[model samples]
Target chain A: MFPSGHPERSAVERNGVEGSRDQTLKVPQRYSSTPLRSVRNDEKVSRHSSLCGLALGLVLIACAIPSAKAQDFLDHVDEALSFSALNGEVRARVSGTLDLEVYHFSGLSPGLIRTTNDTLFNPRLSLFLDAQLGPSVYLFTQTRVDRGFDPSDRGAQLRLDEYAVRVTPWEDGRFTLQAGQFSTVVGNWVPRHLSWENPFVNAPLPYENVTAIGDKSAPYYSFLGIGTPAEKYEHNPIIWGPSYATGVSVAGKIGQFDYAGEIKNASLSSRPESWPITRMDFANPTVSGRVGFRPNEMWTFGFSASEGAYLRPEAMSTLPFGRDPGDYHERLFGQDIGFAWHHWQLWAEFFEARFEVPGFTDADTFAYYLEAKYKFTPQFFGAVRWNQQFFGDVTNSYGGTAPWGRDLWRADLAVGYRFTAHTQLKLQYSFQHEKDGGNDSDHIFAAQFTVRF
Target chain B: MRCLVFCLCLLSALTRSAPAQGSVEGQVDLPRTKSAPVMTKRYEIVTTGGVLGTNPPLAVVYLEGSFPTSSNLPTKQVAQKDLAFVPALLPVQVGTKVEFPNLEKDTYHNIFSYSPAKRFDLGRYRPDEKPVPSQIFDVAGLVTLRCDIHEHMRGLILVLATPHFVVTDDSGHFRLKGLPAGHYTLKAWIDSRTTREHPIDLKSGSTLQVDFPATP
Candidate 1:
C-alpha cells in the first residue's frame, strides 16, 4: 500500500528549522520546518528578519571604521571589528559565518519536502554578537536568516536562535549563572552542531528522526506496522535538534566535574515556534540537567536526564476529557562521551527516551550516535558518524504488539577543507535505511561553503 | 678519510656562522593590550593583528641581507602544553629544524603549517611517543603554526634568510648582532599579515640602534 516514491517516508516534515541551532562554542540548536501539510507562521520571521539583519549590520558598521587607507585599515581592522570602550572595561565584537549548501538526495517526496526544484539549495547566515560587560558578566547571541530555517524546507525566514547572559562570579569557570534562550543541557553534540564547526551536514538520528509522536495531535497506538498510515508518522521527535528552548541554566566546573541544570519553557520535542516564552509559557516547565567528569585532557564523560510535558496546548482538545496537556510528559536519560587525541576526535551519545502519549501506549525509543573525526592536515579533515534508533514495543489493538516507530539507522561521511582560517568548504554523503528496509531512496549528498568573520 | 674531509668541506657552507660584530639594538613600544587577552576561539577574528604573542614579548626583529643559506642551523623547540603553544613566536634562520614536543599528559598535539615558505605536517602524537617531531624551514618567509586538535592553539614561525635577528624581550627590547658591511632591510614582525621594514646600511664592526613604534 506504499507510494512508488515513498513520499510517505514520514521523516523530517518539520525538521527543516531543526538544523539552525546556535553556533558559538559558547553553545548550539536544532532547526527545521513544521508539517508540510500546514501553513508556517515563520514566514513572518523571514519578512521582518531583513529589518533585524539591517539593524545588526548598522551596528557593526557603526562600531568598525575600516574605511581608510589600506594600511591603516589592515592595521586597525581587528581593533575596529572588535570594539573596546569605557577604558577597555567593556568590549564588544560582531562576527558571523555564512553557509551556502547544495543537496542532491535520492528521496524526493512531498511529505518530507515540498520543493519541486531539481537542486535544493540551503543558504544560512549566522551572526554572532559577543559582549564583555565586565570581568564577571558577559553576553552571547546568534541570529540567522535562512530559507525554511531548516535545510530541507522551502521558504526564507529569520530567527534569533540563542541569546544568553553569563555571570561568572569566580575564576576558571567554577560557578556561573546563565539565563535567556540557550541550547539544551541534555547532550554534548550542541557544541559542534554549527555548519562551520560540525564535520557533517545532517544532525544525528536522535535529533532529526521524526517518531510517530506529534505534539500537536493525540497519538494512535493501535497499529499493525510502521508507516502503514502516513499521518501517524507526523507526530513528534524524541529530541528535536538542539532543542533551543527558552531557559536559564547554571553550568560550571568543580575540580574535574562539570555540572549543568536548566528550567525551560518547552520540552525537547516542542516545535521551534514554541521555543520562545511569548508563544508558550513555562507553566509546566521542563527541568533538565547534566553531570560531566573530565578524567583527563583526552576524555570527557557525561550523564544527562530530562523530564517535562511534551504535548502542546493545541493537543488538549484531542486528549481525554478530564486530562490537560501537561498530563503527558517526555522523559529521557542519556550518556555522552568525548575523546580527543592527536588529530583524532571522537564523540558518542546514547539516549533512552519515553513519551507518555494519550489514547496510546507510551512510545519509547533507544537512540545513539558515534562520530569520529580525523585531521589529515591543519586545513583538512574527514569524519564519519553512525546513528541508529530502536523503538520499544507498543500494545496495539491486535493480539500482538509492534514497535511504536520503525527502527532505522544512518551513516554519514564527510570531508572538509578550510581554505583560510575563516573560510571552509565541506562535502558529505549519507546512507539511511530502515530496519524494515522500506526506504531505499534515503541516500543523500550535500556540499557547503562557509565563511566566518 | 679523504671522502670524509670532502663531505666536511661541503657541510661548511650550511654550518657557516655570522661574525660576532655589528649589533643593531632598539626598543619597540608595543601597543598596549586594552584588556586581558581572551582565550583563542577558532572562529574568533584575531583582533591583535600582531604575530608574536597574545599576552607579551612584543615583536620579532630580523634583517634581510646577502648571506649564505644553511641547512645545519641549530634546531629550536616549541612545546604544546596547557592547550597552547609555548613561546608563541619563534624566529629562526632559514633551514633551521624546529621540534614540536607534546608535553601534555593524555592529550595529543599535531602541529602543522600552511605557510607557503615552509609547508609541513607533523603527524599527531602525544608526549608518550618515543620521539618529538621536527620540521625544517627552507624558505625565507613567515610560517603560521597551529594544532590540529585544538583550534585555540596558535603559533608563528618567522624564518629569516640572514643570521642577524633577535626576538623582542618582554619589554619589547631587541638586539640583533653579527652583520657584515652591506645594505640591508631591518624588519619588525608581529604576525604573518603585519610587519614593518626600514632600509639601513650596516658598517663592519659598528652598532646601529633603531626602534619600531608601538603597533599591536
Candidate 2:
C-alpha cells in the first residue's frame, strides 16, 4: 500500500495495436473514403488523447504531493533546519568475519546421543545502509550473509537483520519514534552483538540457549526423540527477547534516565526459517520495553521485560475451541548493568522467564551472564565471560512423569589484537558443562579475523 | 641598500616617537599532586603533575577589549601526522582560515567540525592530492576539529574576537606586551573548566603583575 496522500494507480490500459502503428500507416482506400470509417478513427484518436492526458495528470499529482508534504513537515518542525541538510548524506558500509573452530564433546550418558566432534569454518558478511530522508527522518538497514561448514545443511543463508525508519520531530533528538523490524531493546549486548563489537566469539547463554516452544533443533533439546513425552512439555525461554521483531518503538532520554518500549509480533514457536516473526497468526502480541539510568559516564543499569503468547501455530490450533489463548502466555524479566573505568569494562545480565503450557505443569527458567574485559594496551585486550542457564522442572499431567530441572554453564577466555580500528584478530577457548542426571560436556577452540570498510 | 637604510630610519623614528606601552605579566599557580616515578619509556607528553592535577601549560590567557585593534591573521595550517594533530590546541582571532593537511603519505583523512561556531566536513582525500580549500572560522567560539577516518585524532581551535591572547608557558608564566595603557578585562581559560575574569588597570611604561589561581 502506498503512503498516505500518495496517488493510487490500479492500472492503465492502452490500445496496443493502434498505439504501436506508425502515423504513416494508412487505412485501406475503401475505408479511407468512407465517412463512417473516418469518424471511427477520429473517436479512437480522441480517446487516446484523453488517456495520455490522464496519465500526465496522475504523474504530476504523484510528484507534487510528497515534496509538498515534506516541506510542510519541515516547516512545522523547523528547529533542526541544519539537520535537513543531512538528507543529502548517505553511507554504505560492509564488515564481516571468518572463523575457524574445533569442537570436542564427550561424557554423553543416560538416554542422550553423543555429539559429533569436528572442525568447521564459518564466514559472515554484513552490509549496513544509513540514509537521512529529511531533517527529522532517517532510514537504516543491516543485512548479513552467513555460511557454516555443516555437510547436512544448506551452503549459505542470508537475512535482513534490521530495517528501521526513525523520526526525531523534536529538537536535539530529545524524542524519537522508530518503526519496522529491529533488534529488541531488552539488553545492551543485543544491540552490539556483531562479530566486531562483541568481545567474545559467542553470545551469552540467555541469548543463545533459551529453548523456545516446539524448538526440537535446540542443542539441549535434541536428545528428546520425536513423539517422546518430554517433547510435549516445551517451555519458553528468554532467547526470544533478543531476536528481531516487527514493531514500532518509542525511545528517548529524560535527564539521566533513558527508556524504550515496543509492541511486536508474538514470539516464535520454533526457529524461523528465514526471519523472525514472518507471520502473526494469533491475536496475541508481545510487549517489550526497557528503562535505564546513567548517573555518570562510567556506569549504567537497566531493567527490561517482555510478555505475550509464545505457543506455536500448530499447538494453538490443537487447543479446545472455546479455550482462551491467553492462558498460554510467556513472561520474562531481565536486569543488566555495565561499567567502564579506565582500561577495564564489565557487563552483566540476569533473566527469569515463565511459561504456561496447556496439559502440562507450568515451567520457570533462570539465566545470567557476567563478562569483563581489560585493555592491556591500546591495541590489545583480554576478556572473560561466564554464562549459565537453569531450567524448571517439567511435569506431564497425563502420565504424572516429571523431569528434574537441568543446569548448563559455559566459560570463555579470549584475547584480541586490533591491527587498526577497522580490523582485528582474536583467539578464544571455551568449556561447557551440563548437569541433568547425565554427563554432558564440551570444549571449543576458535580463531577469527574480522575486517571492515 | 635602500631597504636597509629605510629600515634603520624607520627603527630610529619608531624608537624616538614610540608610545609608552604597558605590559601585563602573570603566573598561574597550580596545586601540586603526587608525582609518579620517572618512566624508562614515555609514550605521551607527561607533565610533572600529569593532566588531572596541576598542568599549568594547558591554560590560555587573553585580554578581552578593543584596546588593541584586531588584525587579519594569515591562514594557519594544522598538520595530521601519525594519526594526531600536530598542535592539539590553538587560539586564533575570529575570521581566521585554518587548513588541515594530511601528512601521512599512505593514508587518507577526513577533517570535519560540528562546533556551533562553524560546521563543515571535508570529505576524505589523499595526502598527495591537490590541497583543499581552508576552513574559515568567522564566529567567536571554540571549534573542535576531528578526523572522521581516525576517531582518536582531535584538535581544538579557540576563535576569539580579540587579538591579544597567549598560552601559558611551562613555568606557568605569560606576558601580553604592546598593550596601550588602559583598563581591560583579563581572562584565563582551561579545558572543561569555567573562565576566570579579572578587571585590571594598567599604567604607561609600567609592568603589571597578576596572579591567577589555578583551577582544580
Candidate 3:
C-alpha cells in the first residue's frame, strides 16, 4: 500500500537481455555549449548520432513486423539499446500517483469571523524513483508537486518529500540501514499516507492537529477549553507523528516481528518549515522507533516511542512567561493495531505525549483514532472513523485565561468506488466538535480522485 | 514344410503386434459447500467448466514415472483480456515453453512469478508489444503467475515431467489412453491441493479405474 518497490521490472529486463546476445553501442558525449562549427566538424559525434537513429528506426520496423519471432527480435533490440544507454545496468525503476480533491468547510464559532464557509481545490502529484545501486545498496527518492487553493496555505510548490540511501548488509533484507530525509517511523499511518492507500481524505487527529498553534497565519481562538496566549502559542505542543525528518534509520524484520529505529535532528513537533529549508540541531537529536509484530496476515500490533526537545533553546528563552529553556523536552509513547479479515479492515492508534513547559507544569495530552472500512464488493467500500484529543489539566501557569486543557473530537464517514486497479473516487463528510464555552464546531465535505501508474 | 510355414507365420504375427497399450479412466469428486452458490452468483467462481470451473475441469490428472520419447513440444500461449487470464490454469511438460500475450489495446500488463520452480518477471509492457521470450518451465512444480499492477489477475502453471496427462471434463470424468501397460502412480491436482497417489498395475489391453475423494 505504501507503493512497494518494483523489482519485477528489473528481473524481466535482466532475463530478457542475455549477456552474450546483446551488442553494446558506443554513445558519444557532446557539450551543447561547444561552438556550432566545432560540432559540425566532429566526425565521431555525427557517426554516433546516425547509428543511434538507425537503431531506433530498425526497432520501429521490427515492431511493425507481423511475425511473433520478428517482433521478439525487435524487442530485444530496443532493450539492448536501452541497456546500452544505461551502461548495461538497470539501476532504477520509476512509479507515481496523482490525487485531486475538492472540499468545502463550514464553521460555527463564538467570534465574528469572515468566510465562515469556503470551498477549495487541492491537487498532489507524487513520483517515486528507486535505484538499486548494488546488490546491497539502494537509493530511493519521492518528489511531490502540489497546488493548494487556500488563502492560508502555500500556493504551489514542488518538494522533495523523501530521499534516502539504504544499505542492506545481509542478503535477505533482514537488516537495513537508511540515511537521509525520510518518514518518521512513529506510527502506521504516516508510511501509508498516500491518498490511494488512505481510506479517508484527511488524516487522524494525532497526525493532522496538535501542532504549534502559532505556526499558521490564523490567530488562535480559545473555542476549545485549551487556550494559549497569542505570544506563547508558538511554543504550544502538538504531536507531529505525520511529518518527515532528516535522520538515519535502521529497520529490519525477524520472522513475524519488524522493528525500525530513527535518530532524527528534531522532534516531530519541530519539523522544518519546509523540506527544502530543513535545518538540523546537531546538539539536540531526537530518537524515535517502533516495534511491531504480525502474528499472521490478518493482524498487526506495534508500540512506538520518541523522546527529544520540542523547542529550540534560543526560542524557549524568548517566551513571554518566565520559563527555563532547558526544561522543554517532549516525550511520547504510542500503541497501534491493525486488523484485516475478509473484506473488512480496522486500524486504531493511541498516543500520549508529555511536554515539559518552562512556565507551567508538564502538560500531558492524549490522542487516539479508530477507523474501520468494509468492502461491500471488490469495487466499492464504506468507511467510518472517530478521532479525539484530550488535554490534561495544566498547573502553575502564569495566565489563568489561557485555555489550558481543551478537548476536541471529530467523526468522519466516507464511501469510495474503484473504477480500476489504478483509479478510485472517494467522497467523505466529517464534523469536528470542540468541548468549550463556545462549543465551536465545523462541517467538512470532500471528494477525491486518485490514480496511480 | 507345413510346420515350418506355420512357425514363420506366427513369428510375423508376433512382430506385427507391438506392446499393448491401456487406458486409465477416473472420476474426481469435487468438494461442494452450501456457500458455493453464493460465491457462484457473485461471479467469484465461473461455472464455465474450464479454467475457472467448480469441478471436473478444475483438476489435472496425470501419471508419474513414464514419459513420452520426444521432448519437442510446440510453445503454448496464455493471453490477457478483460482483465483476466484467458486460461486461469495451464499444464505442460517440465521443459515446455509458455507465452503470455497481452491482447488488450492501449493498456499495460505485467506478468511475474515467484514460485521456486520458475521465478521471473515479464515487466510492464504495452499491448501489441512482443511478449517476453517464452518462459521455459524447467522444473516440475506449480508456478503461480500474478500481475503486479492488477492484484486480482492470477494464473497458475503446472509443470510435470510425465507426458501421460488429462484434465477432467464437466462431468468430473477423465481418461488417459494409449499408455503402455505398466505400473504407474496416478495423481490428481485441484487448485493448490493434490490427492494421494493411487498405484495401480495395468494388464495388457485393460482399463483401470481410479477415484479421488473430494477435498475440503
List chain B TM-scores, each candidate: 0.77, 0.74, 0.77
Q: Which ten residues in a row have the lowest lDDT in candidate 1 chain B?
A: B43-52
Comparison by TM-score, 2 against 3, better one: 3
CAPRI rating of model 3: incorrect
Question: What would the per-residue lDDT of candidate 1 be over residues B158-198, giving only the tens digit for each residue?
Answer: 88878878888888898887677678899888654568888
Top candidate on lDDT is 1
Q: Is candidate 1 or candidate 3 better by TM-score?
A: 1
> Residues A37-142, candidate 2, lDDT per residue (tens digit)?
2335666577556545544653443344334334334222221212212223332222234332222222211011112212334556766555444345556677
DockQ of each: 0.15, 0.03, 0.03
Per model, the share of native interface contacts recovered reads 0.16, 0.00, 0.00
Candidate 2 CAPRI grade: incorrect
Candidate whose TM-score is highest: 1
What's model 3's TM-score? 0.54
* Model 3 Cα lDDT, one tens digit per residue, B15-42: 5577678888988775431110000000
Q: Model 2 chain A: which ten-residue window has the lowest total lDDT?
A: A8-17
Residue B105, model 1: lDDT of: 55
lDDT of every model, 2 decimals: 0.69, 0.57, 0.60
